[model samples]
Target: EFRDMKTEEPEVAPSPEKDKFEIIGKSTSRIDGEKIVTGRAPYTHDIKLRGMLYGKILRSPHACAEVISMDISQVQSLPGVKAAIQLKKGRVTYAGEQVAAVAAVDEKTAEQALKLIKVEYKSLPFAVTEEKAMEEGAPQVRKRPNVQKFNEYTRGNIDKGFKEADFVLENTYKTAVEIHHPAETHGSVAKWEGERLTVWDSTQAIFGVRDGLARALKIPASRIKVIKHYMGGGFGSKLGINDYTVAAAMLAKQANKPVKIILSRRENSLCVGNRPSSLQTIKGGVKKDGTLTALYLKNYTSGGIGRGDYCSEPVVDLYKCPNVQVEEHSVFTNTGASRPTRAPGHVQGTFALEGFLEELANKINLDPLELRKKNYSTKNQGDKETPYSSKGLNKCYQLGAEKIGWKRRNKRPGEGNGKVRRGLGVASQIWWGVGRAGTQADVKLHPDGSVEAICGTQDIGCGTRTYMATITAETLGLRPKDVTVKIGNTEYPWCGGSGGSTTTPSVAPAIRDAALKAADYLKKMAAENLEVKADDIIIGNRKFSN
Candidate 1:
């Protein structure tokens, strides 16, 4: 009737040219493509209940302030107002920190009610940049030191390594904060059925939201259900439960009706998370023969009131270096916190490391690609020199150079006739793409010969639903259309949130195993009907025959 499957490590497979599979490596159309393009798919913002109320949040105008008092009596008395609650009554650390919320019959009424609530605040000195926050005698963003050493790493002796080098270079680089403005902004629609709460949210993690709500609302996880059918994007901003989601649920419970809350663009820009800004100073020593002698980095970054990213990973892992030292400090500013953007630290780290490597190659009068080859790392230096299971970087570089016609690159770095100069450059990156443990999938076989694959993973426009169907159909020896994919509901078999590029690798294996079990069952049933052994039967054109 049902099968639950889990896969931990990836099974090694033969090369694509030698292996044969029906749908595993083929190009198949996305299953949800028609529904999405036709605008028939139901996003969280499209959900509307019979007695739904629109919720709006009121945010602080000052970067740092202490709320003296709040008067919401007039807002509560409004005709269409259903519920009003104060979110923050004490010190606000950021400009857009939520201070209050109101739910009313319509969006206009909710917006109007927010204006009626009066709040008094006392402003405090604030730092808006990392330089300002790190300045001596600067206003303290938190109780701790303004610039706290967040993380550090050291390897061999830097002094001895630098002494062996022929030349050294040091420079500073900076990266600005970036926002994840997903097409569907952060939002939630909450409905309460007695003591149980069901929420439809545009989020990457349903279980994360469930756990966050349980902790915040003092309720059991079983009492909450999170669902998301289709999400425009998250890019890491929607990984955790947001304050707006909690506000909607509380408002819906108080008003005894469903509540919908969607953040405006400005609110999202100010309060929602971003990729923290980083200021890195890197020093490197290289020999004339293109061998790296020493590398040192000091990074200062700010994530507003939250911890900043660790931007020293590439420096330690990307190349072979004996002496390396990295120190990272995080400063707090009065702005939005930083969340994991796509690749988090690696993207920013790669930019700084590669830029410096290019300049180092030029200084040594060597080809950049050849210089990188001189210090290629076969093992992960960061993880105690563990040999990689497989490394295709050399092949990738060779192929890339061939495809790009590397021989035709400019001999001089900035040689061009017009103001526009053309140059060819390359950089490499490494990241975590491993599947998460404890992910699950379920497969069901119906008497009508139709199959269904069920998992709790949401499709964040990454072809998850299509791939789920593809894996199930491939394992069961059936067309993809014969399988029905059910996902984005917490009631289904548990799958981890879609992030870190983990959804396909995590869910596909489980789905494949479940389908294999279902296929075995179907084979057993077909053998009995065909008067032959299960292994003797052949499946073709959706038919099981002997």
Candidate 2:
């Protein structure tokens, strides 16, 4: 008794012709360009509420310490102080860990209040770098082990593959830790009305913050409303809830008024997340004909007191090889935890893998691009024999080579005759860009012939609002100006947080479906009014007729 459950028709293949779209791919001005250029667009930093108090956090100055005593009596008794909280009174694993927080009438008063509070600490030995952390007898940042095996993958027999190889090469590569510094720093402004809480945040994920607040404050998710009309940037650091947001909500409740807490530049650097540093050693065996025989990778990375990024993806899947092995280790150190930066693991992994491949090609007397083409894979080696939905790497290589005049490169590496030497190099990258499902949207057709599209996804400054408007207008046979796009509010249809390049693909289809349903309804209505079949009705030029 099995029945097919798919209700929607298969999507039509996209046409490469730009003329197929009325608004897409055209040289149109940004919808919000005027407001942004005129300095009239409001951002989270511009939020202000009546009777609002400013909040500041007190952080540990030592890399590692044990809090012996903390006295906040003087801070609480400050003239302009409204609420104070002690965040930590026990072991502190890293510098900049929040020890306490204070809310006052003004920023100056809050700074003064922070200084008035007293604390005594016992310094402990700490390791700030991966080299020092992995050394024997090093101060342990975590209780279990300083260096722990994080992940590993193996396929086929490496011994057999290496035996058939004509050449083998190995080298170690290193990448430094990077910090995420958005134009506007991380912050939050929280206000409570009765039991309902409203928050204006500079973040990538609103529902993430909403759920985090619910768990932190022990309240229902429905009682919390997170809003971010405009944000400067997030990259990846702002994808999750921050402690400052929770502290602001608590401080507001204690003071019985709204509270605004924005991290200072220094605070943002020390406390917020960073891209984990990676040290990868890759070994490759290749035949004289440029076919890859075996690939092996050993990665050591650190995310401070947290986990490390997986930096072996490129070695495992970027090329075709029967024998592949990868092992990753995440070491703990006395520093800030890490968050996803741009491409996270794949960027660092590709750097090492591609460089190794190029060196291997040189040893085999073959062109680097030619070697890659010889080992081109149409299936994802990592996921068994699953064929790729689309494989365009070979075409990309051809186009890129033709555009760059690759033949004009120096005949030999570094064969220049000046103090400054020149050479041409190439690299490759692979990552997941598929969208997640379970997104939704709504379209409303007004009696006056105007249309509106609603969704809860944030724009994140990628012209998402413009995309919705364009899709809706194209579906309704109306001008983009005739459609109003509403987004960045939790009260609308639910949408997943903006990250992993998921927002556009996920929201566009939902908007298209909603618009299609609206169009169907309008056609049926027109058919009833004109005494004709629905299929005979036509919609164009802002009118529906038979």
Model 1 misplaced regions, further than 4 Å: 5-18, 382-384, 538-540
Which candidate tops lDDT?
1
lDDT of 2 by residue, 1-546 (tens): 000111553442233256766666666566677887787877889999999999999999999999999999999788999999888878899899999999999999999999988899999999999999999999989887899998999999888888889999889999998888999999999999999999999988888889999999999999999998888988888888898999999999999899999999888888889888999998888999998889989999999898999988787887889999899999899998998887788878988898888788888888898889888887787445788999898999999989888887776566789899877777778987666677878888777777889888898888888888887887678877778888888887888888878899888878877776777778888898898999787666678876
Instruction: Assess the local accuracy of residue 51 in candidate 1 as a C-alpha lDDT between 0 and 100.
Output: 89
Query: Model 1, 267-297: lDDT tens per residue?
Result: 8799889998899999998898999989999
Candidate 1, backbone clash total = 0
When summed lDDT is taken over every stretch of 10 residues in candidate 1, the lowest stretch is 9-18
- Please give the range of 10 consecutive residues that has the lowest summed lDDT in model 2: 1-10
What TM-score does model 1 achieve against the real structure? 0.96
Q: Candidate 2 clashing pairs?
A: none
By how many angstroms RMSD does model 2 differ from the true structure? 3.3
